[model samples]
Target: MEESTNIDQCTMEQKEPRKVTKRKFRYIGDFQVSDLECPKKRRLYWNPTQKFMSSSRRKYVTLKTKIHRLKNRINYLSTLLTELTECDRKFPVPRSIDFNKQFVTVELIQGQFVPDLMNLIIRFADSSK
Candidate 1:
């Protein structure tokens, strides 16, 4: 009887699903900004860049690239926040907006924000108008 019980316990253990660990995503170093440029319209524009260690590739990469305008800073941030929330619902996307400098920063994940995803979001946003 004891041998039968042990065999059942072993079978139950083997039937249990194994837990898979996910690789952590983290940012490396400090955020850097490109030189601000003033166009003929006298509007200030700049690009904010940050290096992040890709969770899958395990290498440093430039993940953020967006030109920010000083005039429409608030609108830009709001639009990005709304679009991101509507498009990606799986992982929590964290974003920081610098009103003084007129730039936005976002924590990115590999395979999360591909060009196609961004294009789709942009098109969706535009179509709603």
Candidate 2:
């Protein structure tokens, strides 16, 4: 389970396709991470959104392997949310952010995400652009 191991040990965080693909996706094209073009390789078994992410509770995940899945899932949701919301400077800005990194440092917010706040983020992102 190298994929699982990579998620935990890797310094950066991002979502991974459930299956592998030989096609290479560039950083800034139709298949770019920002575009978040859905993978055509594997049928998307789950459409777990940020709302679902908030509900995810993986207790008893003592093994590093167990935690990897949870962390990677969250990172993917964070990226998607950022894209959908069109966040401005609100997006994570990890000091060493690179293509090889596994995790992004998204701003940590406590409590439920207010719809109003989401709207605000959208407006902010729009204005910045």
Judging by lDDT against the true structure, name the best candidate. 2
Task: Assess every candidate by TM-score.
Answer: 0.18, 0.20
State each model's CA lDDT, in order: 0.51, 0.54
Candidate 2: regions farther than 4 A off = 1-62, 87-129
Please report how far candidate 1 places residue 64 from its true position, in Å: 29
User: What is the C-alpha local distance difference test score of candidate 2?
Assistant: 0.54
Clashing pairs in 1: none
Q: In model 1, where do residues sit more than 4 Å from their true spots?
A: 1-71, 88-91, 95-129
Q: Write the per-residue lDDT of candidate 1 for residues 40-127, one digit (tens) a residue.
A: 2122211111222234333322222222344478798788877877785654676565764332213234454467668989999999
For model 2 the local lDDT of residue 55 reads: 48
